[model samples]
Structure formats: structure tokens, C-alpha cells
Target: MSTISVREFSYNPSAVFARVEKGEAVQVTRHGNVIAILLPGSGPVARYADLVAQGKIRLKAATSADRARLPHYEVPADVSPLDLLLAEREEDDR
Candidate 1:
């Protein structure tokens, strides 16, 4: 981990980002007080995998039985979904 003042970080953000990209954690300080930490991002896929590993999320695909269990609504071919949503919102406001 490395510490840098906020002014130093603001002057050359790309350089600090480069260091983080190379997997170095950086601590940003404001008035000698720690404000933020910049660390390498694992990206969306890695984050999702981590969530799955921690049992925080399930990635189960819906089966035909599951689909049939859900409530069904018939939408008019001429009506826009957005218009329906707006109309629902207007109803809620009343």
C-alpha cells in the first residue's frame, strides 16, 4: 500500500490509476487524514463469481415449470410498454 495526498492524486490521476492497474493499492489522504483507497477492480464477471461463491446470489436458469408458475398478462399489440408504465404511474399518483 502507498499513501499520496489528494492534491498529488488530482494532479496526475492517470499515473495513480496505472499503479492501481498494476495491482498496487493506494491510499489517498486529505489534510493528512485517509480519505479513499484505490485498489484494482476485479470487474463485473469476477464480482458475480465472488457473489455466487459467497452464496449471495443464485444463477439458476428458469425452467418451463418455473415459467408456468409466474402470473401471465396479455398485452395489446398496439400499446407501447412505456405508455402502459406511465399510465400505471399516473394511476399511482391519484
Candidate 2:
């Protein structure tokens, strides 16, 4: 494990990331207090675990009833949903 100040990490983030990529864990400190830890991710599962740990995302086990409760939309066979979304966004911007 390696410790570095936030300013040092910010000035050269790629170097810190390179260290992490080489299997080193880094602790970032602000004013002598540890603020964040950088770790090498294994894959998507590790990414999701990090998000969950950081309170950025919540995971729930959805039951069949929960799936049934979700609203379903019907689009015309010839219509593009992306077009509809863009049109709605355009209206919102005005």
C-alpha cells in the first residue's frame, strides 16, 4: 500500500493509476486524513461492488411480482424509440 496527498495525485493521476494497475493499492489523503483508496478492479462485479460500497448505487433482488409491476410501452413497428426520445428532449430544451 502507498499513501499520497490529494494534490500530488491530482497533478499526476496517470502515474497513480499505473501503480494501481500494477497491483498496488493507493491511499489518497487530504490534509493528512485519508479520503479515498484506489484499487485494481477485477471486472464488472468488482465495479458494481465499489459503487455499492460508495453508496452510489443500490442493488435489490427483484421478484417476479416486481417485474410485472413495471410499466410496458408499445411503440409502432415503424417508429424509432430513439427518435421519440430525442424529440422529447428537444421540446424540453425550448
Candidate 3:
């Protein structure tokens, strides 16, 4: 950091600002006490209004867990649902 009295700012401000651009912070003093700091400006300020222009904020992906809760048709190993029903109806006819 560089040290420059407040009196020097009146003659040349560009020199003081050059120090700030080089990442050197300055302590502006008055009456030998630190009054304020002269440093480079930070980036733009962020606010809530910036989010309105963007889409929904989501971070999760769709899962297949819901499909597992459904009921399934059960039949013998040698017979499908249609074959079991047809066999029952044929027996009922006799």
C-alpha cells in the first residue's frame, strides 16, 4: 500500500488513482488521523431484481421411484394373465 497525504490529491488525482489500479490501497488522512480510504471501485452491486429475468431455479433431476408403487399383474411361471383367464373361462364352460 502507498501513503499519500490529502494535500497531494489537489495537485494530481491521476497519480493517486494509478496506485489504486495497481492493487495498492491508499489511506487518505486528515490532521494525521486516518479519515477515509481511496481504493479501486468494486464490481457492480447485486440486487433482488436480477432474478426476475431468469427462469425457475431448480437443481434436481426426475426419478423413476413413482413407477415402482404401481400394482402389477401376477400369474404362474408357465401362464400369462390372458392364458390364465382363458383357462378359467374354458373350465367354466364345462
Candidate 4:
């Protein structure tokens, strides 16, 4: 972990990011108070994976039975969705 002032981080963001890309964490400070942390990653998706690996994030697993029981969109084969909408519009007009 390393500390970088906000002004320094802002003035040379690429250099700060370069350090992070090397798997180093950087702490940004404003008025000597820590404000943010920059971690090594290409983007949020990669950061999320890193967080998960670090145990900083936890995810719930869905069971096969739970997935099977989930509701699915079932459009009736005999009726067009446009027909239903038109019928509803007609009812509303009346």
C-alpha cells in the first residue's frame, strides 16, 4: 500500500494508475485525510473479481432446484402479443 496526495494523483493519473497496474494498492488523500483507494484492475468487472477473491465481497449461490422453480416468460403460442394489446386498448376506450 502507498499513499498519494489527491493533487499528485490528479496531476499524474497515468503514473498513479501504472503503480496500481503492477498489483500495488494506492491510497489517495485530501488535506492529508485518506479519500480513496486505487486497486489493480482493467475495470469494475475485474475489480469485482479481485474483491471476491480477497473475500471483500461475498456472493450467494443459487441451487439447481431454485433456478428450476423460478418463473419464466411463457407467451401463448396461439395468440400474438399485438392482438392482446389491441384488445386491451379497445377495452380501455370503452
Query: Taking the tens digit of each residue's C-alpha lDDT, what string does model 4 give over 1-94?
Result: 5788999988999998887786666778999986776666764334555665565764344345856997565469998877877887899999
Which is the better candidate, 3 or 4, if ranked by TM-score? 4
Expressed as tens digits, the lDDT of each residue in 1-94 for candidate 1 is 5789999999999999997786555668999996876656764233455554465764444445865897565679998877887887899999
On the 0 to 100 scale, the lDDT of residue 94 in model 1 is 100
| Positional deviation of residue 59's Cα in model 1 after best superposition, in angstroms | 31
lDDT agreement with native, every candidate: 0.71, 0.74, 0.56, 0.70
Q: Write the per-residue lDDT of candidate 3 for residues 6-58, one digit (tens) a residue.
A: 88766788988886675445666777875655544542112212331242321
Please give the clash total of every predicted structure, in order.
0, 0, 0, 0
Report the Cα lDDT for residue 12, model 3: 87
Clashing pairs in 3: none
Model 3 quality (TM-score) = 0.40
> Between prediction 1 and prediction 2, which has the larger TM-score?
2
List candidate 1 stretches off by more than 4 Å: 43-94
Q: Which stretches of candidate 2 lie over 4 Å from their true place?
A: 43-94
Superior by lDDT: candidate 2 or candidate 4: 2
Q: Candidate 3 — worst ten consecutive residues by lDDT sum?
A: 44-53
Model 1: worst 10 consecutive residues (lDDT sum): 43-52
**True-structure lDDT of candidate 1:** 0.71
How far in Å is the alpha carbon of 83 misplaced in model 1?
58
